[model samples]
Structures are given as structure tokens and as C-alpha cells.
Target chain A: METTALLRQLSEAVGPPGYEAPVAELIERLWRPYVDELRRDPLGNLIARRRGSGAEPRPVLLLAAHMDEIALLVSGYAEAYGHGYLRIEPIGGIDRRVLLGQRVWVHPRDGEPLPGLIATPPPHILSQSERKKVPPWDHLFIDPGLPIEQLEARVRIGDPITFRADYLELKNRRVAGKAFDNRVSVAVVTLALAALLERTHAWDIVAVATVQEEVGLYGATTAAYGVAPTAAVALDGTFARQHDVGEDEAVALDGGPAIGVGPNFHPYLVDRLKEVAEHHEIAHQIEAIPRGSGTDAWAIQVSREGIPTALLSVPMRYMHQPVELLSLRDVERAARLLTEFIADLRADERPVWEDEHGS
Target chain B: MDFELLHRLTTAFGPSGYEAAVRELIRKEVAPLVDEVEVTPLGTLIAHKKGSGPRLLLAAHMDEIGVIVSYVEDKGFLRFAPLGGIFPLYAIAQRVRFANGVEGVVAVERRKDESKPPALSEMYIDIGAPSREASPIRVGEPAVFVGETVRVGERIIGKTMDDRIGCYLLIDFLRRLRTSRFDLYVAFTSQEETTLSGARTAAFGIEPDMAVAVDVTLTGDTPKALPMAVELGKGPAIKVKDRGMVAHPRVRDAMVEAAEREGLPYQMEILTFGTTDAAAMQLARAGVPSGCLSIPCRHVHSPGEMVDVNDVERAVALLLALVA
Candidate 1:
């Protein structure tokens, strides 16, 4: 599948944290040809193991990218003028500024997702002070435009909600959509797996479409423990340089992926990734993740006596918002860099601490 | 409760990544108690007492919230970023102690309007050095709040009681524990204040069948505090829901049953903000049923956090009853 088309489908998929089956199904179909074995862990992590061309007990390289997106959960139900509206609570860190005027989907237990519009009091009805303030979760409601009886019967409390934004293609190969904060990274892993089909590697590659990373690094943490890979790399999105974002914190869109370095990543793996990027002449940026990368890398690093984890992130604009933007070229570069790194790994070599290696 | 031991645990300089001091204290206290003990690469202290049943991982972080010097100014001022959640208003005018025992006062830059509290960036630590060259504290030095654990009537007050109190309770439980139906893996985790990284790995390594985190929760007993049902004088709060976790029903029920069976006065906690190590443990490896036992505290994330001694004792009893 073309990267843009796949990304668009991924962007439109409604897979909130704790409910990532939609995205997982898509990933399973796309990653089936490139991997040797595919299965879901008990916690719903999509694990695809691509065997390496090495002897028995081959070193494993785990690639993790969260498939879950930041979304909302219906917390309560209310009625205004006999029309039903639902209150919401955030599933992850969602900026309140973008919640207003967004179209959403309310997924119930046993029915097709109901289309809804995020609504607040009109400007004429809202007080002056209220107009200046972003509506609180309690004040904002999802208007499914259904009658009271139908809304009550169809939508129950605790239904999952997702942004209903369409993927938009922009100039300079940049695309805008929701859930690209991680779905693009999932695509990167897929692209890497696809690239690996034409090449031979020495280490086993387990590409995982991790779930519930938006809520916590649950999927990655569990997958790391279950896989116990020799080393792991997390693919995610970083903040692209945009208005109001500082230069130090944000990278340039379409420049390349950002290779994370800090406490969350082992020094040896960081160096190895940089070496691979430079050797391949892959355009990339060094992101100084002073602490946790707030990605699957954070959990994977500390999983099961600590896996040597690294993060390669494509830069995206307006992170955590409904209209996230990123470059397709950056996504491809990240995949290429990862594939090259994996193919470069030797059967005898393992990503460990510098001091852990023999003097 | 041993106030002296509590004092030692609370006063120890273990802030997030720098948890050696506190880890050593715990290791010394727990090494003799458990059958085996080991420190993970990320510095989480895991001690196991062998049992022939489902493994139960109990987590309590030894690390506390602190600040690391990000920039040392030419004028000897230190600009720091918070290692965890630090409020500028609550931290202003407070003293902080570095790992080397160098003390500095947190002070905000004088602004044109003092109506709103200063941001952390506008605040600097004054260590009394005249210039950058003479500054004893270098950049990247981490410092924690300088407050000693003190007894205020029936309540114990101190800094970092948020989880040190939890650590104390675990130690107390280990001392009193006679037998258990499940394999008890007590993890004195690191970096709960920052990333919960210690608990994350420790849980994975143990791969427990179930886990419970002992930590402090905010109380509404204070005047004009947020409307929570918990208070310091109340018994341990059984986790219901927090920002990070919706406590697994089975694990949460176990705690509630433990409390009810023991006839302990426990509160059902529903904290709208903040979370504990149980959130990380709950999702470790496929998934482990997990919940938290919260020690209701007044003024969380502040220098003068207070917890009731009675509540602490009750929590220990409840844990013992649960394990038994």
C-alpha cells in the first residue's frame, strides 16, 4: 500500500486506548506478508515476529509503535430541550483548545458508531467571561442530534469517543489528520518490515502495534516483557516546528526523523542508531529527550530488567490535536533508517551499556 | 510507628534518578527480612519472600520529587527544571538540600506585578555564592526539599511523605508479616515522582499475578480543599479510580474485602488528579490485576505533607490481614 493512503486509513481509524481493535486489524492485514508469525498478546498488543537469518536463539530487535490515539470517554448523559447530549472525560492528554467545534464519533457497545458534534453554548448565549474561556469538560457536550429516547437507548455512559477528522493532503508532501502522533510510526514499522522482505538480517525483528500507550505505556511495557528482545526501538511522532512551539523543543517537518537520546534510551543504542543514520546518509535530527520520551520507549526501556530502547520520531505539527500534520518523507526516512539499523545488527552483537562490554 | 525510622526515610536524599541514598537505607532495613533481594538496572530495589502461590507485587517508591540545576547563572543563581510536578507558588521561599548537603533557598525574581505566582523559569535557587565560578553546586546537581519529618500531635509531618510513608508502611508490614497465601514481592521502586519507571520495570521482572501500590493520596480535610472523601485521620483508602488507573475490580475487591474482614476503617478513594505505581504495575506483561492502598495525606506535593500515625498503623494491619 502507498504510505499516504495507508496513513490516511490509519488516521481515519477509530482506535482509542483500551479499544484498539480497529487499528490492530488494519495493521495485521498490512504486516501479514512481511512477518513470519503474528499474534496478539493477552493485553491486545499486536506482535508480528519476522525471523532473522541467524542460528538458533537469534538476537531479537523489537520495534514498537503505539496504535492507540488520544480520545475521550462518555462520562455522563444530559438533556437540553428533550435532545440528548453526552459529557466526556479525556483518555489522555488532550488540549482543551481544540476540543471545541470538533466532529466526533461515539462508539456504543453493540451498534455502529454514532456521529456527533462537539457543542457548547452559542456566543449569544454564553456570558462574556465564558466566551473568553475554553469550555470545561462538564460544560462541553456531544450532540449526536438524536432524540432523547433514541440517544438514551443507543449511547450509554462509558462509550468511547474519537475525533472525526478527515486526512488532508497538503503542499510539500505534508499530510494532516488525527492520531498521526503514533499511527504514522506504526506505518513506519510496517514500511520497515516491508523493506526487510527484500533484505536479510541477523537478529529477529518483532514489530508490535502497541495499544493503550496513550493512556499509559501498557502495551509496550507488556510486549517488551513478553518478547524480552535484545533491544527495542520505539517509533513515534515529535513536535514539528510550528507557531508558538519553541525551536529547541520542535523539529522541522520533512527534515527527517529525530533520534532520541537521554536517560530513557541506552547510550549504546543511541550511538548505534546515529552511526547507522550517518553511514546510510539518512537525514535525521538528534532529539535530546532529557527524561522520558513520553512514548513507548519510556516503558520499553525499563521493562524486564531494562531493554536497551531507542526512539525514532517523525516530526508532526499540533500534537494531540485533531488536525496533526507531518511529512510523508520523514516517515519514509524513519522506516529506512530503522530497516538499515536492523539489517546492520550482527548475531553476536547485543545492544548493551558501554561499560557492560568487555574492556 | 517508629518515628526515627520514618525521619531517616523521609530525610534521605533520593530524588528520582538519584535514589541511591534512599535505596541503601531501604536495602539495609529489608535485606535481612526477605529471602532474596536485588537492585534492577534502573535502581528499583526488589525483595522477595518465597511462597508457593500466585505472586503479589507490592510497590512503594523510594524516590521523591526534586529539582535538577539546569543552568548556573553568572551571578551564582541556579535555574532549575522540576524533576516531577513542582508548583512555583508552593515552592517559593522554601529551602532545598543538594546531595552533598549544600542548602539553597528557592526565591522568585521580583516582577512588576506580584499578583500571580511566578513560573518555575522565573524562580531561582540562591545558594549565597557570589558568582558562577564560586558556586559550590554545579549544573545537573539534583536537590530535594529540606524538611525533617516531625510529629505534630497525632500526625506525622514531613517532605516527600507522599511515598516515603508508603515505604515505611511496607517495611512495617514486612516486619509483622508471619505467613501469606501468595508469594510476596515487595518492590521499593524508584522515580515514582517523575516517570514511575522503577515500578514499571520491577513489575515486568516479577510478572506478578496481582500487585498493589502503597502511596499517599490527597485529602479534603484541609479548609477549602478540593472535594475528596478521604482525610488524614481516616484509615487507608482503597483505590477506586485515579487519573492513571481505574483499579482492576478483582484487585480492588480484594482490598475492600481485606478491610471489611479486618473491620478497619478504610475509605474508597476516587482521586480526580494524580496516580501511583499501581497504575504501572497493573499493565505489566499481558496484565496483572492491580490496585493501590492510599494513605490519606494533607497537602500533597508540598513541604509540609501530613499523615496520621493511626492511619499508617491501620494500613499496615489491613495489609497484613489481606496477605494473611
Candidate 2:
């Protein structure tokens, strides 16, 4: 499948933090044909492994991209003037301002997805003070345009609600959708897996479509523990250039993919990846995550003793918003670069870091 | 009955997202009392007691507010960010524990003007690791206040007593309940301080008719606290409202009636800030009527939240009476 087609399907799929089954199934289908074995752990992390030809205890490389995205959970239902307005709390780190006036799809328990839009007060009705203060997420509700009984029949508490929109391909080679944050990475990983299947590497590879990365990197933590890989790479999205965002600070959308360096990133592993990128003449940038990268790399790096992990990020715009954007070229390059990097790893060249226990 | 269990549980180093130790401790405590106990995909320990009536969900979040190592500077000094709501004033000059069993002291930024309180961003934890590379502490590892529960007068003060006190109460109640009318599901939830992910999943899987969240509430006894109406040692506070979820009127009334019938002193807690699992539990099914039984606490969400041991016992008694 084409990367854009996969991106569209992955973006449209409903998989918030605790609910990742739908996306996991989708990922499994996409990855089933290219790998030797595929299994989902108890935490719903889709792990697909391809074996290497050599039997010499080669380094195991983990490639992770979170299948979950930021959405809303219907906390309570409010009926005003016979119309149902569902109260919602954010599932992940979503900007409250972007939520207002946007269309949403309410996935009720047993019925069709209901169409709704965030209810916003008109400027005429709002006082100056009300206008000045940014509305808290609790103050917003989804107007489903249905009566209380109709809504109650279809929608229940804990039903995952997502943005009701399609991916838009912009004129500047950017793609916009609700969950481009890690879905773009998902697309990149899928493409990388497809490329990897056509060749054999010295290292075994595990491509993981992890769940709950938006929440707290829960899926990656368990997956890393279960995989116990020698080396891992988390393919995720990072901040990209947007309007008013500084060009110097922001990674451009078409700037291939950014490799994270600094504290959270393993120094030698990052150096090796950069060397591979340079050798292959792939476009890449460097991101300095002085503290936590706030990605699955944080969890993967410290799982059991220590795993030398590197984070390869696709530059994405409007991160953590309803409509996150990514460049198609960057996604393709990230997958290609990772494929080349993995193919270059030798059996005897496994990088080691100082374990937490000082072994 | 098991003070050793409590000691281990309270001493275990865990913050909101980093709750493996507390989960393991609670798993051991409830292993015998529960027919089956399993940690959920979200790290919540769900201990089930099979019965013949409606399902009853009991929740106590094991996660507490702490700090995450943001950066380790060249001098082995570490900058931190509060994993949850931590008071900047209280964190200065306090001790903390990293996830890897490393100890550190929170250092406040030296300001030319000594009168000002340091911001959370300005605070750093200094563990004698010598250099940045030598420090076992890595970025993103959670560190909590290193303190032990101490009895002062009639109250117990410690780090993470906010909901651990509630966890202690749940363990006490489950151990004492010889017969239960409802199929009880007691969940020691994770990440309640940062997000409600654990409670959302636990409640969905349990699918209970009612949920009673045991947590801590701010008390009016604290000096200059916005009149919270709940007083410390005034028995368990039955929560009516919080920023997250309004208690179902029926559930709230049921607890009130139970307290009145048992002649247990109770207070109505209306929290202006922060929420509990009651929010997520209320919205779990088509709508489960959910309420909260909170132990009135002073200095909530801080390193040293104060709670009366009597209040903890009363909260357990109220839950036992209600579930019985």
C-alpha cells in the first residue's frame, strides 16, 4: 500500500490511549505478510519480528511507532433545550483552544458514529472577561445534534470520540490529519518493514506499533521489557515548522527526519545512526532533547539494565492538536534511512552503554 | 493487621507513572484476599472478589505526585519537572529518590533576592553522583520525595499519603469484609495524578453499577485554605463535587444515609481543584452512579500531606458498611 493511503487509514482509525485494538489490528494486517512472526503482547502492542540469516546472537533492533493518538473521552452528558451536549475530557495532551468549533465523531458503544462539533459561544454572547480567558477543556461540550434519548441510546460514557475529518494534502507537500503525530511514524515504519523484507540484515528486527504513547509511553515500556532487545529505535514525530514558529528552532516539514541527540538519546548510538545517514546521503536533522524527549525513547532507553536506543523523528506540524501535519517526503526518507541504518549494523558491532547497575 | 505490609507499601518509591513497586506491593497484599488479582494493561491492580449481586468497583490510585529528571547538568546537578501538582515551596531542600534507588536532595536556585520563592523550573536535585555521566539518574526517570510516615500527635504525615492512605484503607476494608453483597473489584490504579487512564480501563472492564473512589480531600483546617467545609478528624468526607466529576446524587445520598445509619461522623467535601477516579468511573458504562469517600487531609498534593489515622479508619469502616 502507498504511504499516503496507509496514513489515511491509520489516521481515521479510532485508537485513543486505553483503546488501541482497532489500530493494532490494522497494523497487524499491514505487517503480517512482510515478517516471519507477528504477535501482540498483553498491552496490545503489535510486535512483528523478521529473522536474520545468521545465528550468531545478533543485536535485536526494535522499531516503535505509537498507534494511539490524542482524543476525547465523554465524561458526562448534558441535555439543554432537548439537544444533547456531551461533556468531554481530553485523553492526551491536546490544546483546548483547537478543540472548539471543530467537527468530531462520537463513537458510541453499539451504534453508528455520531457527528458532532465542539460548541463554542458566539462573541455576541460572551463578555469581555469571558473572551479574555481561554476556555478550559471542562467548559466545552460536543453538540451531537440529537435529543437526549437518541444520544443516550447511542453514546455511553467512555466512548472514544475523535476528530471527524479526512487527511488533507496541502500544496506544500504537507499532509494534515487528526493523528499525524505517530501515525506518520506508523506509515514510516510500515514502509521501512516493506523495504527490509526485500533484503536480509545481520540484526533481527522487531517493528512495534505500540499503544498509549500519548498517555505515558506505557506500551513501549512493556514491549521493551518483553523484547529485551540489544538496540532499539523509536520512530516518532517531533515539532516542525508552523506559522510564527521560529525557523531556526523548528524542524522543517520536508527536512527528511530529525534524529534526537543529547541526554535521553544514547550518544554512541546517535553517532552511529548519523554516520549511517551520512554514508547513505539521506537528509536528516538533529534534535537536542536535553531532558526527556517526551516520546517512547525515554521508556525504551531505561528498560531493564539499559537498551541503547535512538529516536528518529519525522518533522510534524501542529503537534498534539486535532489536525497534525507531516510531509510525505520526510516520512519516506525516515523509513528509507532507518532501513539503510539497520542493514548496515554488523553482528560484532553492537553498541553497549553503561547499565544502571554499573555492570 | 499487617503493619509490615503498610511499611513496605509506604516506603516503596513510586510516583504517578512510575508505580511498579507499589503495584507489586499491593499485588502481594491482596493476593490471598482476592480470588484473582491481575495488573491491567494500564498498570492497575484489579483484585476481584466474586459475589452474586451487582458489581461494586472500589478504586484507590497508588500513584502520587513527584518529579521527573528533566536534565543532568555538567556538575551532576539535575533539573526536574513536577510529574503532577507539586508545591514549589515545599520541594526546596527536600530529599528525593530516583527510580534506580539513587538518593538526592532538592536544591533551590540561589537568587540575588533571597525573599523570593524559587520556581519549580529553578529547582534541581543533587545526588552525589560527582559528574553528569556518573549519575545513575537519567532523564525521564521519576523521583519522589524520600520520606517515611511519622506519627505526630494524632495525625500521620508523609509523602504520597494523599491516595496511598486511601489504598491502605481499601486493603483494610477488603481484609475485613468476610461477606460481600456485591462482586467487589478493588483497583489500585496508576496515573490518577497525571491522567485517569487506569481508572477508565479498570471501570470499563469491571462494568460496575456503582463505583466508590477512596481518595484524599483538602481540609478546611489548614490555615487560609479556601473554606473547603471538610475538617480533618471529622470522619470521612463524602465527596459531592470536584473539578472533574460531580458525584451522582443517588450515590452521594447512599453514602450519606449509610454514614447516618452507622452513626459515623461525616463531612461533605466540595473540592474546588483536582479530581478523583470518581470522574472516570461515573462515565465508564452507560453511566455508573459513582461517589467518593475521601479522608480529609491538610496540605494536599504536597510532599507532606497530613491526615488523621482516625479518618483513615473511619473511611474504611464507611466503605465496609456500605459494601456489606
Top-TM-score structure, candidate number: 1
- Summarize candidate 2's per-residue lDDT along B210-266 as a digit string, tens digits: 998999888777668787788988899999899998999988998998888889899
List candidate 2 segments past 4 Å from native.
A1-187, A199-235, A240-312, A315-359, B1-4, B111-116
lDDT of 2 by residue, A1-359 (tens): 58788889989888889898878888888989889999989999999998876576767899889999898999999988888889999888878878768899888877778899999788789999998776887689999888999888788899988887788878867788888878888888888889987887888899899999889999998999899888889988898878897543466678788887644556567878889889989998876553456889877865654466789999988887767888888988898999898888887776642221121
Instruction: Return the TM-score for each candidate structure.
Output: 0.62, 0.60
CAPRI docking class of candidate 1 = incorrect
Query: Lowest summed lDDT over 10 consecutive residues: which window, candidate 2 chain A?
Result: A350-359
DockQ of predicted model 2:
0.03
Weakest lDDT window of 10 consecutive positions for candidate 1 chain A:
A350-359
State how far residue A97 of model 1 sits from its true place (Å).
Answer: 2.6
For model 1 the local lDDT of residue B133 reads 100
True contacts kept of each: 0.24, 0.00
Which regions of candidate 1 fall more than 4 Å away from where they truly are?
B1-324
